[model samples]
Target chain A: MTTKMKIKTGNSGGYDVLVLAKHPMETGNRKDQKTGEMIPAHFIQTMVFSVNGTPVAQAHLNQGISANPLVGINISNAKPGDTVSVSWTDNKGESDSAETTIS
Target chain B: MKRRTFIKGSMASAALAVAAGAGLLKPTRVLAADWPEAALSADQVDAAMQAAFGSGDVTDSGDVQIKAPLQAENGAVVPIQVTTSVKADKIAIISEKNPIPMVTVLDAGDGAGGLYSIRIKMGETSPVHCVVSSGGKLLRATQEIKVTVGGCGG
Candidate 1:
């Protein structure tokens, strides 16, 4: 349930933070290939982004998001060595977080 | 005195349980309580707009931009970027033709003002809508994307 996140310094004098999370994002309408049983909905419901322990942005997502969801935002005034973190929780009550230092 | 104290203790614990049950105890994480279920599950675009943005009229604005290919090769993963000249407190993506019209909503706090990028699924060719909530006004922009393959599972 871990997410792959990256932070890049943008040309406009801000940091571009991106998070790519791995999940099936099933819409509960998909059927299994072998069993023909419908797969229940399993997608990340919320994602929270923080900088240096302060919450910055939050995203409300659903099954409409692509599998291995990727989201990005530009954070201003972030200095080198600052920690930017992202955490996500899914419909199945599973959650994981990742952090990266601004370089 | 003992009976009164016992009664007070039970009531306090009951309140706490109710709050926790509503998923309001976690301050750090955006819990299910904050998720807009009605809007996301709304089948039609107009219904979804009502659920998400209430009855307020959303005017089309030239300041908002939706950057995506006019033709998407893969409906499973279509990259979309949104930028706005207005101060964006929140940004919402809606696909007109999907089973569920509302895709996702981003609460752009002070740090992330007007730039957001994400990947979404599109069932077919449809007009992707971007609605930005700035101040008390709802500004919107739409772009039609032609998808070769359907994204939603069959």
Candidate 2:
């Protein structure tokens, strides 16, 4: 469980997440077959979701976008266990979080 | 009235200090400039977070659609579904390079056709941008997925 979170309650018409996270989002430009250089794009600029925090959705991403980036959020009142959580912040600041509780 | 009038005012103040140091140079940099000339390569899928989307007026048709997996064995999790009936609420997803590339922003209050799903994380082989804003106006669609595990690490 390095990073991957998905929760759904109420709307799955467009389909809600069941499983996610299989990262490799490297943007430093590959090279380390032993020792090269170039590798410096961590990913994720900002992400916030809440059940006890109360925000729901937010996005501002960049970097031609692609690389271990999953942000699928769509909730009406959130049922199940009601403790779904996620937090992210990047651009070298480095912050990671993940949570799940659904039956 | 002395030394030819101070050498013509010191040669007009040294030619106005060399034209104010050549107008204070440094005005030729536009910032990285190479957004999407082609080779995108970045995805973590399902992104449409919003603080600002489209800035101003945009309209097309077909309501907007991005049902993922045209080719993604595993760019992390490239499963996305975004539908729209042209409602007046909100629906967004952007994965143009998932460095916070504005991914996921869904709010279809009554819960209707502004459907949405998630699972994004691709770092190589990219092109997944589906923008949909209603009433105010802004609609877009793009699909191109192909990630063979670990976004861009593999």
Among these predictions, the greatest DockQ belongs to: 1
Tens-digit lDDT string for candidate 2 (B25-53): 32321122222211222232321232444
What is each predicted model's overall lDDT from 0 to 1?
A: 0.86, 0.55
lDDT per residue as tens, model 1, B1-154: 9999999999999999999988656442234657777777788888877887775489999989999999999999999999887878888999888898899988878868567899999999999999999888999999999999989886
What is candidate 2's CAPRI-style docking category based on DockQ? Answer: incorrect
B94 in model 1: Cα distance from truth in Å?
Answer: 0.4
Cα lDDT tens digits for candidate 2, A50-92: 5545655544344434555555645555566666566655555
Q: What residue pairs are clashing in model 1?
A: none
- Recovered share of real interface contacts in candidate 1: 0.69
Candidate of highest lDDT: 1
